[model samples]
Target: MANTTSAKKATRKIARRTEVNKSRRSRVRGFIRKVEEAIASGDQALAQAALKAAQPELMRAATKGVLHANTASRKVSRLASRVKSLSA
Candidate 1:
């Protein structure tokens, strides 16, 4: 459907960007899931570590435009609180 050369190029760029974004999103979700698993297992130490590791990944996703800034902040805040409540 992209008749113009510029439109075709733009479509290609969008496809590439979509793949990259999808990968990033999946990676971020994996990190979040790890943290959740740790929490569910009731291993405070592991949960804390996973939360620490995930914080940066979540923030990075937001920076890369994969997630909204406020959404990331809220997630980090809630996770941090949950981690804090866990005994050492």
Candidate 2:
């Protein structure tokens, strides 16, 4: 469907970028899941550690445009609160 050579190249680039973004999204989800699992298992220490590890990954995903800034912030906030409650 691309009429120009440049357009074809752009399409290719988009496809590659989509794959990369998909991977990043999946990775972020995996990190979040680990935190959730730890929390559900009632291991406050493991949950806190998982949250610590996931915070930067979530922020990085937002910075890279895989997630919105507010969305990432809200997730981090909620997770942090839950972790705090577990310890307290």
Cα RMSDs of all predictions? 1.1, 0.8
What is the C-alpha lDDT profile of model 1 across 3-55, one tens digit per residue?
A: 99999999999999999999999999999999999988989999999999999
lDDT per residue, candidate 2, 1-88, as tens digits? 9999999999999999999999999999999999999989989999999999999999999999999999999999999898888877
Point to the candidate with the largest lDDT. 2
Supply the TM-score for candidate 1.
Answer: 0.96
* Candidate 1 Cα errors over 4 Å, as ranges: none
TM-scores, one per candidate: 0.96, 0.96
Please state the error at residue 17 of candidate 2 in Å.
0.5
Q: What is the lDDT of candidate 2?
A: 0.96
